[model samples]
Target: MKHILNTLIIGSLIAATASSCTAKFEDINSEPYRPGDLSADDYALGSAMNNLAGCVVSSDVNTAQFTDCLMGGPLGGYFADSNANWKATISFFNATDDWTRVFLKSDKVLPVLFSNLSVVEVVSQNTSNPVPLAIAQIIKVAAMHRVADTYGPIPYSKIGADGSITTPYDSEEMVYNKFFEELNSAIAVLNEHPNDRLTATADYIYQGDIQKWIRFANSLKLRLAMRIVNAAPDKAREMAEAAVDPQFGGVIEQNADNAAWTYFSGSVNNPLFVAKEYNHEGSKTGGDTHVAADIIAYMNGYDDPRREKYFVKSEWTGIDYVGMRRSAKVPELKTIGRKYSGINLSPNSPLYWMNAAEVSFLRAEAEAVYGFNMGGEAKTFYENGIRLSFEQWQADGVDEYLAKETKKSISYVDPNEGINSYDKELTNITVKWDESATPEQKQERIIIQKWIANWLLGNEAWADYRRTGYPHLLPATEEGNKSGGVVDSNRGARRMPYPVAEYNDNAENIEYAVNTYLGGRDDMSRDLWWAKKK
Candidate 1:
């Protein structure tokens, strides 16, 4: 929440070096004053690129816990916090500025991205190849879009411009349009330099694979296109069509082409693994996050083969893959919730940026709903998404799994406390694609599978839930509805309130963003620009 200008000033100082020596002294002290004096190609641009990659999904443990595990994961119905102390936070529909501010903090997404982007730009200027700058642009969109999605309007397109402390907020529509433009420009540049490996050592996602970067940029464009469909249908169709047209470049279609940030053995551990399985005592069980009941119910009912891949079995008596329901009392949560299944990630696992399965599902929706040419029919893309997810997890029985037309999400049973249990099936949606199904049902099918495939990428899942109302996530319990009637218990929290620091520092812009751009009060209950009511 610190002013972007302050962060930019600090970053610029760190990036620049002082050369105080006169011409005569320079001849004697021929060595450059700092690393910045090195040739642009010799500068540590890879480190800047790697940091940008880490910021995409956040490799830091605490940041991951705050932004992903405690907020997006539960809100998206993927995982719930097992630590009872956090029950009053966003997981319970309550917006705590202390916790929510971490997403926008100078150390988190925005400042780090803008700073590193500046470094990339300055370093890449002397080089003729545009791949580094283009990749940085793609990374900028990848990282900042999450920030924009978290809060409706964000200080984008003008963060470091003119170096003003009171940065203006861009409307959600404006932010998304800028994202499209950045992706288009980056993809064009990368396409021109198809074999450029200028960013290989610095690139953690694809090791400077320009083709993969182009594919990811296109895939990202497709995602944003779908995100804005409800708000701007014509533009959404135009961008989505352009994304998969193959003339510019193809979208992510194979598992090998998936975009992810890998964890170097000694440098940084996977943050999700640390947040979910590593504790202060260096043990796994007491970590804060556990699989949420919604995912468990859906997977259990389907008899999903990937359960073993997704979660470790619960240590509690008579429970296999039981999940902790949201909003359990502190006493029950601390005592029993700790025994629920934790996420099955390891410290060395790669944090995914985007995957082929998600892209396939996007194509499936575009084809089914918008009648776009996604290189195949809806069923083909839908089935391919399932197959790709299974393959990604190394799970078996995909052939049999796709044939499942009868299984649906089963009822959630809390063996320890019936108060947390749901008696009815979560949803009646099935696995196999049905040609005669209504448009809504088809969309549900595609999104449900997409949600399952998008495990741990909770922000995207949350966005999809808000946009399409798919997977029919279980509503937060009465105890979890802590928004004082502002947020609907059934609908859940829509967007995080603007950072409290913005109110204290940039009061005028915050007011303008709320009144003019948000078109509603600055609260968690209001729907974002892309959010459609079910």
Candidate 2:
């Protein structure tokens, strides 16, 4: 949403490389290529993004395994690392950078094109369609947000122009502001022109529905606004205020308007789909990661029946649940296209990307932060968050999950709590959940729930855990990851390092940027500027 624009100003370099994509070149027999219109090959940009986004989130889920990795196999069942599972790959000890390159490419290229991704935006020019432009704008903003949020200050505004590898990076603060402006512009354009044709075509997501796009724009904006409250309170408050303002509107009221890309089963089972598909056929893969203990406790505490549907307890695991250390050796499974050891609800199955649940929770968070909120938004989001997560998983007894949250843990965040105020808030969440949970228990619930909602989404959960140190995720034991996969953060790992290739080639500039934004590129313990404690 609005956050996308701020990232755009940071200038993420366009990602042109792809597995199937060929180098763009001029044909000797063809007329000289013009620079104005994007080449026919440019379409691959979108194609690549669809793949990368799926992979990125899939990787994210694998890591968090709020489903299988941390909870499914490990804690729930006597842990077993099936061939298709991500337990070995994501065990707390084994974080890796294998997926960063592709993810960054998707994050960057889409944003570059979106900035000026000319989908014939001109009305009278006979080619202008605000719909595609808006979608592109939205995606671009979304893409850049992903890159910037994860990598810290990246090459944003100055990225496109072919300068030396030493291109300077922008500050996270500056990058965020640009995203706000970009979303604001997109919203304004969609409202004014409303391109149905191009939107129908370019809107690969929601099929050119302007209203849905609008909600996505607003919801995304709210998320961005909430993200920066710690770093830029005044700015964050303004963005949040604008989001709730009736005139400006807010996010989706229900799950129907979820902004997500659906994956096909066979060749296009999306990343997770394909990954599962191939793994099922005997792939060299890790076992399903188990759900985190805190999450299990919370759901179980609330008697959240969704547990069965959301996760499959390994029949093999005789323990309450078995969890593999990131360092644990994963069983090899030979497979072809895809495989499946764990279970993921279908795209049409509900809980996907950023949705009403998250937006509601975000609003609740914003209200809690502001201290003036009646918690109307918070309660709605909280209830919706819990209910939707269960329903999305096709959890068994629907009425119970819905009826479970009667005892709200509002008092957990007292200033007297042992830890930070944020910890207190999270405690209330668990406190609200547990039959006899303390304030600490309640806080864990909030962080755990947030983590649950963030499953298969992005690194936001990891980042949140680091920033707040809530939910108390267990560190990968010695049996988990023997060698650290990616850089580590205080709570876990901070922002991942820029790819080795980027650092190798663009050493000077990357060094400068990293030092400024994250203190040190190799120092995983360093918090991002925005994430650091005052």
Candidate 3:
């Protein structure tokens, strides 16, 4: 009895100490720390930046690609629950921000940025400190863009809570417009602050290089402009043209200077690589999130050299796990002579992005929308975009493996052939020679090629799909699934909504905001104001 009592007392004391420590320690809190507390010019901003970047494809962009990523499979992999590859777990169907759920209290970077801005403004009142402030607001804009872009309509200019109760969702149009204004504003600020004292350590991106930030700002402007292509074409052209301004700097001209985030350098690991390839034989999160049949068919049909790099046959055993992307019954490797085309799942694989190919493609689309069938020029841009995409993924040997262009060109194909054929429930879209296609059809072919160019980066692809409606996708044959739901293998949901937790907790404000803008913000298929009407 005495010994037991002693053990109980010791346990209680230990528990009390741990409790006290947790209470005082900062990590336990759901709220972010006040930015004012930081006294250094060098502040940590990588965590917030990573989340903003990760939320795009690694989060839900793959499943929600709606059009681009599913080039191989038949029943677009988006609908099938049997998408037993590593990606399905990373992306799943209806959840874009689930991985971000646990870190929900508040994004840590916002307050830090606001605090930095406060200091910058106070320090340089009379002088125009446009450059540093521009960079700062950029961080703000990037973070907010992810939030707003992911969840259709969201709180923007009205973000701060003057100790107020809740925030409301802003109109999608208003939000997009504000994004334009903010980028311009940031540019002005960058122009104002030419001080050399500014350091790059704070920005994980470009390391505080104002010039690069300017280029990124312009690039961001181009991206946002494209978002509004359907609603306002002239406006889109105007903004895109403005980005090409030599004065503002512009998107990466070369791959060397491209804005990118690397994971291996720090404790941070590439989320995609970790979940799919490098970690636990792709089984940790779950293996081989079967590449959609549509995606498989498209690549195979083109004799796309990229096919090998992007996917591996189950018969090939570099990585263990379930079938390939097609949900195919992977045959015996030795018997079939099928080999696993290894994915560059290196922990060292580039986790961060801002690829040059994106800029080139953005330019191509910009030209296309602006009536630039301007001969081979537009096609060259399109081709360059494809080349860059292939090169990046190490799939450029397409000339060797894929069919060369013939007098009569083929376009799209049915991926239901031989080893390409997966399970019964799936269907794929492959590129075949369509000699009957006219020059315009050839243009559609060009767009389709660009479509495949967008692989891991699906948000941009989704945006492009919204703009052009290319590659022909059928709606997921589901009843309850209004958009990209469990049955939504064909079409992606229009937008992710605010978390149910946010809606329920702040019911009144959320309600007012939804009713004010689009009827029910929860409806994924209901388009954002700036998005095309189709």
Candidate 4:
């Protein structure tokens, strides 16, 4: 993508950090260790922004494959593994090194590219200017939230401070509190300079549009606030209200206002596209990217119009759309791969960081859950989410689709399975909203729709599933988790354990974090503070 140049800037910074200092020298860290004037420029800020956006939408890198794609995509029931190696982890819930990849890229690269000291220096240099600093803070919050959400706790406020090389982990509460504070600071600054911007030349997402940045900040706040609904309802309500509060800035309401990162064709293409189209090693076939059976069953049952754009027909079975079972083995997956639908792997696909459909669904959940004001009734917002999702994909027949109230998720039947392949009927969840449904039923309906609307965004779906336990997903295969009887196969994975490297150098900190926030164990079965079901 054209944004490849932006990533190269951050890549060079990572290389510089790796080769700058020798392992045996502590006294040789003075001149060459310092960033030049170019590192503190607005272009650097642009590079940092690009880097954060890229990670948030990561699907290609090893770190992202484990954290975002493997943990998220499969757990959320969006995709299934093609290789037996990956399938073992996905189906049996085994702990692997793949889960550690996200932190490696994030810790070793991003924070350094936009160092905290450099950002503070830039802010001090531009005392009369708040746009640059505000933008930097928003990017920081965007990047850090993914890390904090994946693991229970992280080094947030003091990551790059002097003498904080091996920073201690803050509790999840502290990290979220800091996120709110930073977002508040950014929103206040953005409000002060409503339309002003320092630079947009390097911005690949919104082109230096400060107004869009403000909207994105508020939208993010809404997301973070909703994440804590089970653990901190009062705080969630307070922040959710503020997100829609006209006194500050309003939440994202239009598809045109969505925050999506664009990509250039060729070598700088979207990683997800490359993985799907090219002969990635883990995939079953050279060009097979199978969708999950649950999604296909639900979409096909609802007569979804977006399926045409979301998936391609199977060349083997000659079926219009067929999704693979989540626990299928390599041989079955290989044959089924020939008949299963592949995702839209066009190099031109945009990576949506946040979208209006998500905002609408969030508002719907807020209204349905607590009767919070969201411009109108929860049903209206819910329907709008469906409409906007269709519009975003440029699909038609939404009005006709929305009008049907009898459509429900159909029972799944593996096309390649014979008499017994663990085919189960899904929850009879329907697309249309029922006015007289119970609160719990309404909540389930809302979340199920949200899950359907949010295609390719597996992390958010996984979080919501863990939080709400809606869109009732299939259980792990009979293989079960390889946790030595630690992880409950019925419960599924709650949060990823910290990287093994964190334990090597910062064992005390990791121990403290696990004991403080994770109930004295650094295991995958333990839920994060916010993920505990009410």
Candidate 5:
């Protein structure tokens, strides 16, 4: 393979430490050399693939804690940081550059993805098989779209084009278009080579199962389609319909076909597990991360069985599954937050990319809200989503769970501090799908169930919260609104601002992005192109 030396600039941005990969590849812990330096025979496709996989949601403990736990998890209402020091950060709608920048920076998502993709492109060109490149494209869209969603305009279409640091930013709308184009191209290529196993040993998500990859791509397409429904309804309907069409291969509809990054050995641990269950010394403690009040309230009210699978009972309250309130005082966070329920996960737990349960809910939303042909009725898909979620977690009581019509999210009471408690029931939406309900109500039901099913995938949950405004999340407590009036306490942050590094490194392009595409300010208060209007 002809190595491209120019891409090393991007690689330099990524940490040189070895990534935690699946044990099937014995050399998984070998340090990642610059992508441009690898020769044809020396190229480690498995390592590159693993690195790409890890960067999607980040298998690294610190990266995951920062991007997911501190930022997306709190904003998405799935988690809250138990660390009192973080009260002024993204968890409370204050977008600190240090906290919010991780999602955009080298350690987590973009630089590593683009670098590996460049190497994969060269490999595809030298070899006749197109499988690896197709798979790489799918991974790129999966990872980069999250970056785009987090920050409105990003260096998408132009990254690594000529190895320039000052790549132009693409508008969120344009970025979504490029995502569709890439997914379409990838789906076409994979469909042609349905039996290809060129990257089988290197594939961590699906083991180079071409058919499964195709399904994942379609499911990703459906997700992107639903994301843009409010922003671009016509295009969203067209893409959503195309995604589920059998002729173009099908979306993930079975639990067996779920897409996730798996770690075979204990040395390479799941990030969420590490963040919530174990301390830095690998000893068990009241972890720095805890389940958020919003999710626990919703689940507790419905008596959801998945709570047992998703979180452990609070240490202070022994029997109750308490969660930390985002707006709690620093003293409460230091004392009560640590006692709140931590995530119920093990070191080897696989981090999900997408699952059948989420797909079923997406189809439900498409059918119920958009009136699209999803091969089933909206209520059927909605209930199926709940059922699949129960099965995914090995939780029982599905029949009774789905039959309940009156159970709704209950009020949150901070046992330690009554002032922090929210006594009024937040949402009236129930578990059972109501066919007679309006389209908006049905959408709420679909998204609420979807949010519940997407337990640890906080980034997706945050995006859904922005897109549909369902599962009414509690605002950060008055003390937690540290945005200096840039963000509303009630509405929360709309999107993360561009990292300061972007402004320092690529001033011209960043300026243009803010001026032309991002409404003249790189502020978290600004809504993304796909977000529901305030």
Candidate 6:
């Protein structure tokens, strides 16, 4: 009994000693330093900028490659599948999910951009420095607008309101109007600090140049304003005027001022260049990317100097620029892959969100459509746009190319049998600014050239084509539209379907949006408010 009692006393003493040591060292479990204490500019601004750039320019499958390269590239008629691979993407069949990925928060870029912007906005709440906050807001609008354009109604104003996980959506129209308001607020903030440094070190597009940000903002405004011309002409004219109004700021007027983000050197090369032609076996075999017949024929017909830069000479057809038709499902695609022209594969190339050439074309369209004071006639702006595009790409013979009016787009002739051939003479459309052409003809001329200048910026090009129905994109008849009767594959996809997660997580809001904004259904057949046919 004495021995047992002694053991109990020893155990008790050890327990007490252990408790003391644990209490003494407990503080070590906490963080050495809190990251939350950092200022928005110190962290949030940089995070927002990088995240935004990544979402728009990254080569990851879920981001830029899927949304821009795979979908936008082919749909915009800038490229075609040389190997006839990725049929689901090329044919618009089984493509709904890829389209919806642009808006979904499931590891996609849009949600990351929004989250970073929110952080920036919160951090700037107590500061007199509005530059960081303004830049965040501007990028918010720039990035979200693409999302809004992808699917008709999206979570915009109510994204994180009321601390709710399931956010309600704003109508496409409401989202567009909100974009204008956001731009106005951001511009005002920027104007207040004319000399203040932007987050240049963090910014990939402008390197914190406040003036360039202002220019990009105005250029973005102009682009958005033009999008609403058909659906909301009065509002379009008003907003467009506001964009170019001297009081706000000037638009991007030179190639140097274009909103572009270059790839990081070495390991972080351009994703498109890597994914399309250099990443894996597909890339090693030259991948499926080739110049679209639609675009190549037009360029070849006009003797466009950009052709050499845009594509490699065909090895099979023995032609300098052989292209494949978009959405062509032929056995020949499997055999004659090397015969087609290859796309530009520079790993260091910059991804353009908007360019001076595109902005000039927007101004031309504005002057032609609304008679806005663009400081030049529509014809002058039109010609300037062409020259800027040539200079932007470092192409020669701008004068000679512009001088020819009679050279029409040649019909695409497939060298392989069993492949469908189109000989529509795309060049029947001329480059010469015909002063006496009908208003419709003039609009076509402007939009087609604008499309040419647009080149690789697939989302913008696709959006513009949806809005104007210009350049007369050929209809794709291959199946895979899951919308049943909702999407007319012939009219082309109007918008991507709302993500399935919305139906699961935010069912009530999704239902209401479909009923009110989407005519009782969520399908690609339904046009966004701005893209509706007039």
lDDT of 3 by residue, 324-414 (tens): 3322333232233222332334455654346666677667666654553212355556557666777777765644422445222122221
Q: Give the C-alpha lDDT of model 2.
A: 0.48
**Per-residue lDDT over 1-534 for candidate 1, one digit per residue giving the tens place of the 0 to 100 score:** 333443454356335311110011122222343444544343446556766676778866778888888888988988876655554688776757878777676455666666667666756654555778899899888988888888888888778822233588888999999999999989888888897786435666886788998999999999999999999989999999999988998999999999997644654477888787533232234467778888888898898999999998877677688776765433244456545676888777878889999999999999997788778899999999999999999999999999997885588877566667887777788898998988888999999999999998999999999999878887777787878888887778898887788878899888998999767498888889888643
What are the per-residue Cα lDDT tens digits for candidate 6 across 17-100?
222101111221123323354333444345445555555544453456566666677767776655444545534535646455
Candidate 3: stretches off by over 4 Å: 1-39, 43-130, 161-165, 191-200, 277-290, 316-343, 372-376, 398-403, 406-443, 473-489
Clashing pairs in 5: 327-477
On the 0 to 100 scale, the lDDT of residue 283 in model 6 is 29
Worst 10 residues of 2 by lDDT: 20-29
Backbone clash count for every predicted candidate, in the order shown:
0, 73, 46, 3, 1, 5
| Pairwise TM-score winner, candidates 1 and 2 | 1
Q: Which stretches of candidate 2 lie over 4 Å from their true place?
A: 1-100, 105-126, 161-166, 194-199, 263-266, 277-298, 317-341, 345-351, 372-377, 396-399, 402-445, 479-490
TM-score of 4: 0.87
The 10-residue segment of model 5 with minimum total lDDT is 13-22
Q: Which 10-residue span in candidate 1 carries the lowest summed lDDT?
A: 17-26
Candidate lDDT values, in order: 0.78, 0.48, 0.47, 0.68, 0.78, 0.69
Can you list the residue pairs that collide in candidate 4? 1-264, 1-268, 63-101
Tens-digit per-residue lDDT, 1-534, candidate 4: 534543454455434433211111122112333334234344444443444445456524444455545567777778765554453364455656544435533443344434532533343354456676677677677766776777778776666622132578888888899999999999998998887865443356777787888899999999999999889888998888998887787988888889876645444555566555444343333342467766777788788889998877656554577676554343344444566667765766877778899999999998988777666789999999999999999999999887777875465655665421445656766777888888788888888888888888877888898889878776655554566676665567777777677777788987888888788987678888899876
lDDT of 5: 0.78
Steric clash count of candidate 1: 0
- Model 5, residue 17: displacement in angstroms? 8.6
Give candidate 4 regions above 4 Å deviation. Answer: 1-42, 85-91, 104-128, 161-165, 278-289, 316-318, 332-334, 418-420
